[model samples]
Target: MPGSFHGRLFPQNTIHLVHSSYSLHWLSQVPKGLVAESDLPLNKGNIYIAKTSPPSVHEAYLTQFQKDFTNFLSMRSQEIVDCGSLVLTFICKNDEEDGCDFWELLGITMNDMVIEGLIAEDKLAKFNLPLYAPSIKEIKQIIGKGGSFKLLHLETFKLKRDSNMAEKEEATLFDEKSRAAYIAGNMRAVQEPILVEHFGEEIMDELFERYGKKAIEYMKNYGKGIINNVVISLSKTN
Candidate 1:
């Protein structure tokens, strides 16, 4: 189930339970802008990539995320029985080199959209996306600061294509087309906002058509067979 943390709407300790998957990275606030003043274009490329390029605007968001997440945990920590667990999975970059390249790709794409005037130049220029992939050490620090949890199991693995296959492996459940659609769908969530901003309603239809085709081709040709997966299981110690 999804939970929300508005920082004020819900009282502290009013209820008890939290579960999240691939959701923590989506911060509540919009990222810092990235568009330059001089180069606004229309019908641009991927804007998210451009908007988040950085020394990590995502990092800035994490500061707030940490505060909120910690508060959430603090509230829950008081209620959970000792040994209760909190399990989470989030996207992360294990290698700095790989992480840098990945964010750069996203940033450059958004910059292109800005050049095309698909999104507001000022919006792009000021946009700053979060770039947080906490290491085990970092997680430990957070847990320590929160002061109520103990780490139980920590593991990181890569999710591969074959991992999606069933034991018998007679045939993959999702066909190539289906797989492409799935990947493209996820990409669209990040791309849609940029497209809308840059092209407006007039060009959005065509923009999506282009985005869909390119995303499919890119996934087929370049997507890694694997993605990094981090699993952390925490228990209330106090």
Candidate 2:
């Protein structure tokens, strides 16, 4: 059946365990202040938080994540039986400003299109990704405040460029263009739906084309970008 995780979807005290993977990073919706009705968008020219994003932009994203994640824990606590547990794995950041290069690269690619008249500058200015990679400290604070689950384990890991590539793909990954294409393809898979919704399907191929080239340049200059993730085990409190 169709339901939203923002509310109770299961019978109380029925679920014994919950396993969520690679999903909590996404907010229920885009942060509010970024899409104000009358003023310019706060996070202009960047899809996600970037080095250039103002302090308010960063604060807005953080607030939304906090609210969404708190609701998530509250709903799960109701569904899970006493003494049951939950395991969660999702993207995270080491620091507030870290681990945004991939999105920044995509943002720059879109900006390039704007410069060339392929996309409207206002369109680029109004778009923002509804994703946040919270720090472990932030995660701990929220769970602690809720007083519903006891944190059992929490750890972070960096996703290396070659971590899960197949042998054949690994061999090809050594080539700059091939490696860029590989990463861009993966990014497109996750982001294309929202992108198409915002920018239309006509620009999808060209968007990724520019994105791949930007990735290649990043590889040559700064090496592969780091993708940080966190896994936590929590037990329901009595």
Candidate 3:
């Protein structure tokens, strides 16, 4: 059965099966510290879209995430009489000591933008995109603390991109006009509030146009690929 929480929809407790795939990575809300600046190019006055502030903020967010998630499990663990399981799939980097590769790349790009005056320096300084790729050890700690659950299985894998597609495949497939539209859509995901904060709406649009073109060219030249790891399955021990 499905239910609602605070006018937001969710599955009710009657749901014997609880499965989450690629969804847990989204923190309940964007980190608060990162959205304080309203006039910056990337700030956009929207907390959800602004970049995170200070690397420590990421840790603080994750600690709260784990605590809330544990409480959720504690509340629901007793509902299942025979067997209950929680499955999570999230994007994590191979290195546990440093940040994930995705964020590292974004950080590099963001820094370059800042230096070029495309984004505000203060915004960049406060910017810390969330990258909570907990180590295998850390995952174990979370599981142990959260619930009385037995570890059934755990695995890690890489995410790869297709090589066949051109840098601007949609443009090539359709026409120049269509290509422009396709690029706009793709850039929206990458641009948005971050660009808005640094450059405001007008300049951000121009920057996205320029950066999007270059990014496509880079992808076309250097094959597309991503390296991501995952932890698979766990069972309730109680």
Mark the regions of model 1 whose C-alpha exceeds 4 Å error after superposition: 1-18, 31-59, 99-107, 129-132, 160-181, 189-226
Order candidates by lDDT, high to low.
2, 1, 3
What global local distance difference test value does model 3 have?
Answer: 0.52
Name the runs in model 2 displaced over 4 angstroms.
35-38, 95-100, 166-174
User: Can you write out model 2's per-residue Cα lDDT over 1-238, one digit (the tens) per residue?
Assistant: 3687767889999999999899899999989898657788878889999988898888899999999999999999999999999999999985434444788889989999999998899988989998998888899999999999999999888885434553564485367666667777888999999998988999889999778778777766766667889999999999
Ten-residue stretch with the least lDDT total in model 2:
161-170
Strongest candidate by TM-score: 2
CA RMSD of each candidate after superposition: 5.6, 2.1, 6.7
Q: What residue pairs are clashing in model 2?
A: none
Give each model a TM-score: 0.64, 0.92, 0.60
The deviation in Å at residue 121 for candidate 2 is 0.9
Q: Write candidate 1's Cα lDDT for 1-238 as tens digits.
A: 2346423333444434445576555556553333335544221333333343343434544565666557756766765656666777776555333322333444455455667876566655544443345455666677788877777787888664334442446646656565545544555566567545544566445444444444445546775445566777787774
lDDT by residue for model 3 (90-146), tens: 755465332223344344555567678876776666554433555666666777776
* TM-score for predicted model 1 compared with the true structure: 0.64
Candidate with top lDDT is 2
